[model samples]
Target chain A: MARLTTPLTDFYAVIPAGGIGSRLWPLSRADAPKFLHDLTGSGSSLLKDTWDRLAPLAGEQRVMVVTGRAHRAAVEEQLPELADLNVVLESEPRDSSAAIGLAAAILEKREPGVIIGSFAADHVIKGTRFFNMAVAEAVEAARAGFIATIGIVPTEPAIGFGYIHATEETELEGAPSALKVDSFVEKPNAHTAEEYVESGDYLWNAGMFITKAAVLLEELAKTQPELHAGVVALAEVWDDHAKRGPAVDKIWPTLKKIAIDYAVAEPAAAAGKLVVIPGEFDWDDVGDFASIAKLHSSGYKKDLAILGEGARVLSDASSGILITDTGRTIALVGVKDIVVVDTPDALLVTTTANAQKVKSVVDALRISGRDDVL
Target chain B: MARLTTPLTDFYAVIPAGGIGSRLWPLSRADAPKFLHDLTGSGSSLLKDTWDRLAPLAGEQRVMVVTGRAHRAAVEEQLPELADLNVVLESEPRDSSAAIGLAAAILEKREPGVIIGSFAADHVIKGTRFFNMAVAEAVEAARAGFIATIGIVPTEPAIGFGYIHATEETELEGAPSALKVDSFVEKPNAHTAEEYVESGDYLWNAGMFITKAAVLLEELAKTQPELHAGVVALAEVWDDHAKRGPAVDKIWPTLKKIAIDYAVAEPAAAAGKLVVIPGEFDWDDVGDFASIAKLHSSGYKKDLAILGEGARVLSDASSGILITDTGRTIALVGVKDIVVVDTPDALLVTTTANAQKVKSVVDALRISGRDDVL
Candidate 1:
């Protein structure tokens, strides 16, 4: 916990860490957003989990975090072992594309021919052994001149994620499950998701992408030429240490706001230059309260998913999640499929069926000028 | 606020306050039961409401509250105007029959012809004008050597309360609405409740009984002789302040536990000496969280019934109640008919339909040795 000590690896891991996670409101807020919360009941924040997952592969010095300027202190505090130079700070949000592109550029400039894998700071991935195996395959595929995405084999007919279609096996060495990407589809309806699951060709696009730093820049240059040049310029000044502030303030605001998917993945797939490492590891985005409920209700809780510091008393209650950070005893009676999140300043009650619509409550509160709560 | 100043009526009022209100658990606890809580959100507790309704007719000196010894301080603190000698504190709970009979015997010993009306401490009643009129009629009927019970005209076919079957219209000169009670029936099933509501001869037995102290003692002597004689002997010693404690210590523990309705009302009805004064008034026992929700979902909140302090931001929620004493902001999404009660140490979440089953939760917690929350 005090210092970072691990064997060195060539490839750097980049975490694009920013999002309010408005759908998990009351628990997730602008001041302390999704990445800062321990939504998975794993006793650490999602940002910390991301660090723990990547640190073994890349070492603490090689694992870079790209986050908003407002969250720089929090990121540094959470990842105490993170090297000062490895923390990439943006003046304001420019979306996933610019954030990850900046990290790729910095790593490419510092060490030539370096490979980097971009992961979001607020995702939950289980089975570290399987994840490490998939990442190793992804690294091999990335070095073989392909933009590699770690596509999780779909466990259920989930419509909440984009689907990566793997068409045929590739002849990539050291990566047995590497497949040529057919296309990437947007989140589908239930029927389409069911069809995708049944077809056995579709994997959930977990937004994990491994690529040679120069290759990603090359693809970015072709798809989003201006954004690529801007990140490259910021990366050059970022390495100078003293000039990062002025450089970020000048270029980050002008960078076109877009996600990495629209900026690189879609175009790379269309050009037939994308390969996917099919990963059977259990993964979840922890997208909403419903997902968290699912995580806790798996084994320990057959009926009630209790998280944080509190006791629970259930009477005729079957399925629900109760999260209490305020040390309050929760009693549930005759309710099912419910979610109750209790904090000091705010409390939330909703059913898992309506979890996706929680963002509307945050929006409503914002409209009413209750920014103090939001 | 300080002292009693009203002129006393001939009949004294006895508030038999002892039930823990287990149905309204977490909010109503053994330490602070329903009578001590402001279930109506009207700024005063139910016990205070009962006193407000009765203090006009019987001065504070004449109003006696018979409660368990543990609640003596709470009762005295809430009713500061009440005379200390008028507070009857029992060593332990012995049910309504002993609690009320003791009050009657004490009043009868103070004055041989005294009429005393026993009222429960936790029922909510609206229209003070109607309540005053009913009490006036019942008092007149009580002086006519009949046990007068105020039966509420049923507004709905509720299976939650006992029924009073009145057969013949009585010719009591001052009490025009006095009807000869054929019998007192226990809480019936839905089918019988609906049938009785349509029959136009049955009224809800609200357990408001007015009788000559001697008549109540005489009836208790018939049905529960041992309990009646014990309370009478205790009353005799109670007049002498010094001997009261030893007398209660000796006799209170020997009194048999029973409800006044079973010991007196039912047996007196069989003897053709019970008369019911039918009174129509808005009344609720505040039996559960569902009743409290109905109270608040009256004029403004057509959907969400909110009680106590704090603010709520709701989305797609209807027909639910949220009770929060803490100043936490509550956000509820897409839930209907839900009951959420939040306190400093405990929380309860249930549906209004299942509000009656909250005691099971308390039992569960107690079984788990969580008495601190209960």
Candidate 2:
């Protein structure tokens, strides 16, 4: 993979940052979502990390973020270099279809045929060189008028993510490694995931999509015309601050809530208009403590991984991950694969195997009307 | 079982309050040991509960506490009804032999042939009627010049406690249920403990000893003459406040460090001067979180036992014990048999199977010079 020093021409980056991240409750809350948190233990937050990764490829002036109004201040605070016009705020979440669709419509209105790449703000990526290489190839495939998605090389038979099946028979011009997508599949069960990993043609869909703004809008118009019309109407008035508020207030609520994968990628793949770019970069969504444990396992001491600044922890015959935000000293004894998240106001204890079940705790708290903690 | 309303005549209660209780770390610290904590969630400290239980049997005036100098203020604060003369404090710990012997020597000096029953301050007991019946019968055996011990009926093959072997062939005259002690054994391995439980002749020693103060001192004179002489010397001037400090400071350091089980009980049992009284009351030493879990299992919700006042906890498919002192909300998800102790300065996470290993965490903290948390 070659590292590109110069920014790609006519390329715009759109970050869709919205999710309650209930599985990471107490650490990732409703008001403070996962993207705003420095879950990687890096000095910068996930949002800032995403910005840093994309700024070299898309340039600072061409980067945009679409987030809920509640997180607008946090996004702006985390990325001070972001232009005010590029900060698109939603009154409420309408899911990925509206978020990315509106960004594509706005970018298309700003500059015709602008190649826009949409990436999630909360995902963690390593190997910036490979990431840049894959994005550049995806951009080339996008310039040839095809919706291109970066399919992450399968590292394990992970059932937590959707898969993209691509055939090597048809390769796109200019994009040397691009392959024709056969289909987009939903999250599979353990047996199916194992088969998919063994097949070598399946890749984990990391939700990285690159396409010309016109091409994405065209696909959305074909699959979800009502949502496409709602976004296009809002995009026409988005630059006009005077008309933007009323337009969003009227049109945003009327848009059908759907994910971009379902609204465009699946339909486009079915119609033979989508291509997959193989991405060899290491990626993690940081979806649960198990993902977190895997990310920080390299820094484990006595088989225990501890995350936080100046955290005091003592472990004896213990193998676990401790995420502490408080000044209290945590002691672990004779535990294995445990996850302890200790915050000032709340504490969560579970195991890495049951990391996905933490959402039930949040559900319980919500049902019991503990909105104060939620 | 019968309950006695009136205080027993000529009967005195001695409480030996000591031990760091490292197994309950973060909840029990060196400065504040287990006896000072309200571990049972009964709104009273263990020492206070011991005083309340014994005050009815032995009048408040006849109750005595022997603890380290550091815990004197806490003991006094928890038991305001305790007389100043009865609050005996050792400058440093010298094991139970010295602590209990000094109390016996002092009571003998105040009144010869006075019957004193020594009970630990940290043990939990239920069925007050059965406990009173056992204690009354033990007192009768004590009056017959035999060292009487309340032996708990075996509920399980618990290897954590010592056992007393009692023969059903010989019985005491005054105490109808009293049996002759064959021998007292130290803590055994799992196989031996299982065998002891199956034999039906072995009983768990709850360390409840009832004997005449003069007889205890006489027995101590035979087995441990030096310790007996030292306690007698300290007891001579214990009432004189002006001379007490210098006497304790001089004699305490020279006293032998030995547990009463080794110095008195084992030797007396071998000499056929010990008797065991069956106690059917539910008793727990509260040795670790496992014991704490068993003691409070009846109040468990969803197989989880919680011990704290006004603690906010949410459990989802979790079976464990949570002992929290902080205002933080503790949420347990998909964890089984876990033990979480959350305090202001320190937090502890372990399992009921590994509860005893918590002492190793304290040891590590001490070795690492983290005395502030210890």
Once model 1 is optimally superposed onto the true structure by TM-score, how far is the C-alpha of residue A151 displaced, in angstroms? 1.8
lDDT of 1 at B28: 82
Model 1, A1-374: lDDT tens per residue? 11224432678999989888998888888888999988777889999999999999888788999888789889999999999888888788889999999888888998989999999899999998788888888888888989999999999999889999987999889778899999999999999999999999999999999999999999999989999999999988887767978887789999999999998998998888899998878999989988999887875444878777544545475577877788777778878898888888888889998999889888888988989988
Best by lDDT: 2
Question: Cα lDDT for residue A7, model 2?
Answer: 98
Chain B of candidate 2 achieves a TM-score of 0.96
Interface RMSD, in order shown: 1.1, 0.9
Per-model TM against the reference = 0.91, 0.95
How badly does each model clash, as a count of residue pairs? 0, 0
Model 1 misplacement above 4 A = A1-9, A41-44, A68-81, A166-170, A173-176, A223-226, A299-302, A310-312, B1-8, B59-61, B68-85, B299-302, B313-315
**Docking quality class, candidate 2:** high
Candidate 2 stretches greater than 4 Å from native: A298-302, B1-3, B168-170, B298-302
Residue pairs with clashing backbones, model 2:
none
Q: lDDT, candidate 1, residue A243?
A: 91
